[model samples]
Target: MDPKIKSLPTMAFPQISGIAALGFAFLIVLGNVFLVPAGLPHAGAETGEVIAFFTTSKDIVGIASMLTPLAWVLATLFGAGAVSVLWQSDRDRGEAWSLVGFGGLILQNGAFAAVIAIRLALASTTAHDSTATTELWALHDALFMLNGTFLTLALIGLSISGLRAGLIRQWHGRLGLLAAALLFSSATLAPLIMDQAGPLGLLGLIGWLMWVVWVGTYGITLIRGGAVPIESQSHATSSKP
Candidate 1:
């Protein structure tokens, strides 16, 4: 005779959280693959000259190609999809914490967008004027600071979800938290390590891209069906001591 199964406690939050994580991952990869090569400043002999070269060129298609994925990430996270995911979860408490993480992610990415725009603007000012400018450059700096702050907070909340709860079922949360640390440091602290990396840090972008791939792959997995083996209610409950 076939065995009967107990209806395990449903973890609906995890199902939707998995989906959102995928969206974040997609943009990260899209940004790296499409945007970075398409829009990054070209290398000339001197830093200032290269910045000047890119300023005049200002390839709108290239810029749009890069910024498009970023815009999607921002819009999706703030949109109804993310909120629906939060709502569908089993417990209100988990949803609350996830909201904090979601808010942090949106704010951090938005601030980072400001940083990128500011950098492009600064390039324009630096190239056109013979004299160095501070005002536009300072906007970029402040935005970077804000980005770092929000990114750190988001990672912290995700970390708590993994550690405090000891929720191994949320592997994506753990992975995301780790990826955030790598990318955040790469973007913010690369200059301290080397003069060469300077403004365009390679490590941070690489880390972000990897994060995108991981999250996207996981998300696609869910859309094809559900989070079967991992996020399944029976699967999660069976592993508990």
Candidate 2:
């Protein structure tokens, strides 16, 4: 372990992070459950449909938007906790994968913030301003699709690092990697996928579902004290030597 790196409380960090991760997942699922069936507009939705959704479902959108900030906060906490858990192993191996994962979490927070802001802006716009609303929705779709890149990065970095450090089981690591691949594929095809609301959107949706599961399980593992820190192991090894 690097002396420069401040040590985190093993017990507290995992517990807090586990709670945050579960909270984050719950909020996301909650928002989607309400919003998706409420006729939330998809990418390339008709301008009229988009406007109608914002106008009719203003309360739903507002509620979901309100939850977004909290979700972002929880995600950040989870990422920070994950990094702390992986810090010793990463340092010993001369790797910064956890930092990469952390970066992705931060970037995605900003990206999703923009996405929600766009939704709010659209809600406020007059139906008469169809042109502006359409343009705004387009931007929202682009941002939403592109946001997968950050998610992919987060999954890849953390999954690989955690697996290498034996912080997560092989099944967990494989699931994360698979989710990352799906998300990345969706992001890579964003231009095409965003043009029309087709089956391509399912790719992202599936990946997102997997991501939620992955995070939730990770949180559960932490809560159960499954993620043993590499620092403790290192200390044991070093003392013996």
Candidate 3:
């Protein structure tokens, strides 16, 4: 490592925040996989079915639904942490991209929180109004469109900033780009092709997992006292493919 790199200021707060974000994201995945039903029906599910599901899975659903919003909130903080690190590094170079990424991430979290809140409301309610449930579920699905699009925006901006600012490795930047592409593809093509079934949402999920790993690895590097300095930015940018 360059001497200048070793002299740079440590970013311990953002590093810790990033690690926390990773932990929260893992909780979300675990909740989804083990707590929520795999074969749950979408919008237009009968009132009886909805009630039955809520009645049967209420405990786990309540816990998982609560975890969902908490995880998303952590995601928003993760975005902020990225912004903090990059912005502190070079105000002029990383500010715009970091802000853009942060904004997109906030929007994505809001969208996800909305969906989770709706699910929680549905699960908690004792009223068996099929039409109301259907309408809410439809709204939930519609809001889900924001998830992939905003996530793509966040990834693109962060990856570009990371590449240009030398905050992360070239391979990591490329991984972010790939994840963003997958999210964008899923957001655009899934709705058009999958419709109500929305099987293509899996693409977004996979991309999200890829993104988690990329960000988590970067966070771990930072926590391990990796070098990131202004003088080394150019050399870091040109290091590898």
The most accurate candidate by TM-score is 2
TM-score of each: 0.57, 0.90, 0.78
TM-score of 3: 0.78
Residues 24-75 of candidate 1: C-alpha lDDT, one tens digit per residue: 6555555556434644442212445445545655664245446555554543
Q: Per-prediction count of colliding residue pairs?
A: 2, 0, 0
Higher TM-score: candidate 1 or 2?
2
Candidate 2 total steric clashes: 0
Candidate 2 ranges with C-alpha deviation above 4 Å: 1-11, 229-241
Candidate 2, residue 119: lDDT: 91
lDDT of each: 0.49, 0.86, 0.71
Q: Which scores higher on TM-score, 2 or 3?
A: 2
Q: What lDDT tens digits, residue by residue, belong to model 3 across residues 32-107?
A: 7755454354443455766677666767777777677677767777777777777644455334777778888788
Q: Summarize candidate 2's per-residue lDDT along 1-241 as a digit string, tens digits.
A: 8755656534578778888989999999999988999999888889899889999988888888889999999999989988888877777776788899989989999999999999988777655488888889899999998999999988998888888778888999999999998898899999998787789898898999999999998888777765656564575356552
Rank by TM-score (best first)? 2, 3, 1
Alpha-carbon shift of residue 123 in model 2 (angstroms) = 1.1
